[model samples]
Target: MPDIVNHTFENMSTAQPHYDVIIAGAGPVGLFLACELALERCAVLVLEQAADPDSPLKRMPFGLRGLSAPSIGALHRRGLLDALDLHQRMKNPFVGPSSPGAKRPAGHFAGLVFHHEDIDMSQWPDQPDGLPASLLSEMAELETVLARRACELGVTIRRGAAIAGFDQEPDRVTVHAGDETFVGGWLVGCDGARSIVRKAGGFDFAGTEPEFTGYTFSAELSGAAALKPGRNVTARGMYLQSQPGFIVLQAFDGGAFHDAGLPVTREHLQDVLRRISGSDVTIETLHLATTWTDRARQATAYRNGRVLLAGDAAHIHSPLGGQGLNLGLGDALNLGWKLAATVQGRASEGLLDTYQAERHPLGARVLDWSRAQVALMRPDPGARALRAIVGDLMATRDGATYVAGRVWGLGTAAVRIA
Candidate 1:
């Protein structure tokens, strides 16, 4: 049971509707979980606070790889590729000893594993399945696609219905949404950082201080005729360079970043771009700007009794290596089927508990590396030495390849649910 907050405006005493499973958010993680459950013919209800597509920041919008290479194998196991409409958002895999694309390009230090430059896609473990049978990326579009799939599978998506309260018993939960109520045999909180379900469910999210925080404005750079030569300055952000926080002047085709405090003044951005590119460049940022603070963290528990957490609810970490949303989606995908089975009653209730033991350690590793990488990003002297050591290590054949494997997303493995 949770501390009840009574309200007058939204009808506090409506009879709650019953559902096999009720998810408190309609974000990508929640929607994806809904789709996964609907596949098993589990009745699901997704409650989203906002109305329509303008449903707040339901999913992070960036052209980020959906999941790193290792987890993609897990996706394959779940038949996610076959189920979702993810055809274009795929990356070239680079893991283990040999990757055809690992060779450095001539002249520029773009491909060198040292400095972690030019992010090698080849360092991730090879999928037993060849060439993405179905590849998808970019979370903004992902949300829309997954929602449609869940609907097709008969999952009911309720919009503008914020969770006002919930009552949880050992076997079921009754949810309060403005004017409506829902009962569920199980609940999965794939909600965002400020999760009401998490709060109502009495889950404690223990987090270390945001060891580091940075601001970013992902620029929609329209390539200037004068800026053509500076395109080679594709190294990710101000890391390995002497700068306060990271300033990544990337060719977006449309790209995104989570750094804030980067002076959005075109002159400031252009100046930073010129400094990094070593060339006079002219670039214009399209009107959209994003300001956010990223912290390295993971939740102490992935579950709280019948209520479970996934995605940002379970962990919030630095956006380095573009792992935030990827990891969240993986969390949704990992917990979805088990929840589906548990709700359907084919599996024992204990199945859901495994989510914590499996995912917590993996997230801890992510948190540690997120801190280490951000530490490497800081312009301070200690970080400088650490970067130097990293550079030196990458300079060696074994060290470079070894570190490259980790940096490229091969190091993390999935929390095996079975």
Candidate 2:
């Protein structure tokens, strides 16, 4: 059984309901943080803007996310790893060589495939044998597991309560969400890239603009066979036909389409696909689609007085190597215990300040990493030459090992808080 805090204030109607921490956004990071704090006997309330958790984008190929070694280890330590079952049934869609004797595809760097046999396990001696360096998980399922765990730990979750604004006092933060108000000792913004808390708190979000607007969609296509099976880097842009109906394309449009907020109609996608793939692919029926860019940004400071930031609220980068989720999870794990210790009055002075000190550097590194990929993925001649050189290096043992380490998050310095 989980250790839960029994608050006496619930019986007092005259007093305002106060919690140890109020977290904005019920994403995996927020929910996982809630579970962490509640495990340490802290009262946590998570406020989420979304009313319903179900969304088509959170279901299948669109919802697919890669869990790195650090993230997997954190889940295992918390005993939440076994609850995830999607990996058991779903095979990795990212495939490599099909030759009978060739090594299987493990992961990729800038869409360049790396095989499992190429990775030197000896380099990662700390990672035990049979333990997966990475695993594929659906966003919806991961959230469900985290939300369940948070609830089990006695964390209160209020859905459909978007944080309109918040006022941070020396002792408490009063959050205005929808038509209701909530007061807590500390406020954490785990809300995504466009976090209201970050903006309202006046965090300096700094970084590079996007080079291109990428598209991921599911649609019925004619002449689908013209597209390649795996990731294809073309003269115009990059495109990947993961399955018959599922396709991903990157058009070097300087993020104009996405920024303009134009609807992703069948005509637009078909046009983009034709140009990027250089094929006359007709989109018979567009099913699901979403647009994203490689815009990299990070908060100069993760905290302002009593308000704090986590997940995409703290930093954002392209989903090039799928490092954003892992980075956010790392932030929650690093912050949870420290914040709980502070709230419980057991932490030494200046412990909470260390959250940004440790996490900011890591976040900056990830942003640069994504930026590097964007540079390599550009359609220009310089980028193509760089890609050739990088590809040659990636084929080597040392190169593969280094890339694998970064991709699997083994290269990151572990922040162990006991």
lDDT of each: 0.58, 0.86
Model 1 quality (TM-score): 0.71
* lDDT for 223 (candidate 1): 35
lDDT of 1 by residue, 389-414 (tens): 77676676666556545543556564
For 130-193, candidate 2 gives per-residue lDDT tens digits of 5588998888888888988888889888776778999989999999876668899999999999
TM-score of each: 0.71, 0.95
Name the runs in model 1 displaced over 4 angstroms: 1-17, 54-63, 74-126, 132-136, 211-213, 218-286, 395-397, 400-418
Clashes of each: 17, 0
Which residue pairs in candidate 2 collide? none
Looking at model 1, residue 229 earns an lDDT score of 23
